[model samples]
Target: MSGIYPFLTPAGDAARDARESAARELVRSTAAKAVESLELRLRVLGTLGPALAACAAAMATAFRAGGTLFAFGNGGSSTDAQAVAQVFRTPDRDGGRPWPALPAISLTGDAALLTALANDVAFDVVFARQLAALGRPGDVAMALSTSGGAVNVLRGLEQARRTGMVTVGFAGSGGGRMAEERLADHLFVVPSSSVHRVQEAQTTACHVLRELVRAEPAEA
Candidate 1:
């Protein structure tokens, strides 16, 4: 059989090679951007050590006083809120010794309440209304927002403050309005613009805080 057909011209072969190189470079650039984003998140987490420590201390104090934890967020952040609640509510066992106690509630878990509030009052009142009904002094309210500007989360924080709950906010990109408005007693800011990076850092922060609370001795 005849040899495989060659390019019609030298220029054609060169053009094809250039296009392939460009495609490869594009892939590489995209991968590099993703890696860089993760690296930035790691750096933000490292920088948040002190803030996380403070949050842990506050949580420890609250738990010791028999205070519950209330969490709220929007969209993906709502999942994070539920995760935080579960982390605290579930007992961690290593060998025979059980970890310290953590009682947490995610405001987003009740679909009935959410739908009722959203339909009757407004979306922004879902969490706030719950806080008014269920929260008590000495409890803690943990709010999550990728943009740190979700109106519903803000309303929850407002209600938390009025009810004397300790307010904690997980926020990204300079903590947005939460940072500026001083809405949180402890605000953990992940300093990235990408939602994925912020979310990863937020998860890490929550786990760290939970572990810290778990490390403390149970109240007498």
Candidate 2:
């Protein structure tokens, strides 16, 4: 078959021919996947407007009231939770910014606390336990779950609700149990199969949520 290496082959000659061909093929395959991932993210952007705005309102209310933000998720979603919290806590603005540092905490940030909950009680209650301890009315609870149906994620949301904190969720296609159960007050679901794309859109949605918090409410 024809290939991109034909015009200028590596100097190693036959010894590197097989390796070079394999590398070229890998690049092509990865590039195609990247294109698909970008497309999926674009498809989900439309669904985020309302959900993100609603979430922002909740977050802004928390900020205005001196309430803290508690964020959590499982696995890769865990990382997104951390990223979202950091983004909010670290704001951007003109003249070095005027808003005070928001108090945003990630449930996954405390290793000892998580291990203790997982060891003593149950993995499902890890986030629930923390919320029970640190959360109060007026706080915001943000959870990231690609599938949105993770048992642990559900438990966390349930606990957040009981604690009177606003619940926000970011999920992939179908919205999983998050949508089914209507656990989150503000739930955004990406209409895509690729986990990467869902997360990419989710990250953008998160930043937008922060922006809305800083933005003046629309005149109505």
Candidate 3:
């Protein structure tokens, strides 16, 4: 059969031929997945106008009131949580807008605290207990869960609600329990089952959210 490696003559090494074929397939699949992920990100962002605006408005209000933001998640979502906190705490300077840093915290940042909470208490209460101690009225709770269904994440949202904090969620796969329970005041669900695509969309959503919040006509 014809192939990209034309130099792989019919009599060439069989192992090298197999490797080239695998490499070609890998390149093709990776490009396809990358394009798919980008498409999903755009689609999600396009549909996020209303919800994103509402979330940004609420967050801006909270910030105006001197409220802090608390973010949490699990596994890769935990990394996303940290990214969210960082993006808010340190506005990108590349925009040349000279935006002020916002108040944000990642609940997963403190390994000691998380481990202590998990070990001393149940894993589900890690965020809950922290919220109980640190969260206050008018604060914001942002939880990231590709599946929309981490028990600890759900508990954190519940705690945020009980404490009068604005709740936001980045979830995927039909919004899972977070949607069913109506935990977040603003929930953005990327209806895909692929975790990578969901996360890519969520990251874009977060950046857009920051832009919206900054665009709000409120005194800093």
What is the overall TM-score of model 2 with all chains considered together? 0.86
lDDT string, candidate 1, 112-173, tens digits: 98999999999989999999999999999999999999999999999999999999999998
TM-score leader = 3
In candidate 3, stretches whose alpha carbon ends up further than 4 angstroms from where it belongs are 1-12, 91-96
In the range 77-196, model 2's lDDT, one tens digit per residue, is 999899878977885564765655688999999899899999999998999989999999989999898898998889989999998998888889899999999999988888877788
Off by over 4 Å in 2: 1-15, 95-97, 217-220
Ranking by lDDT: 3, 1, 2
lDDT of 3 by residue, 1-220 (tens): 3467555445558867876887799799999999999889888988888889999999999999899999999999999999999999995554676677899999999999999999999999999999999999999999999999899999999999999999999899899999999999999999899999998999999999999998887675
Number of the top lDDT candidate? 3
| Predictions in order: lDDT | 0.87, 0.83, 0.92
lDDT of 2: 0.83
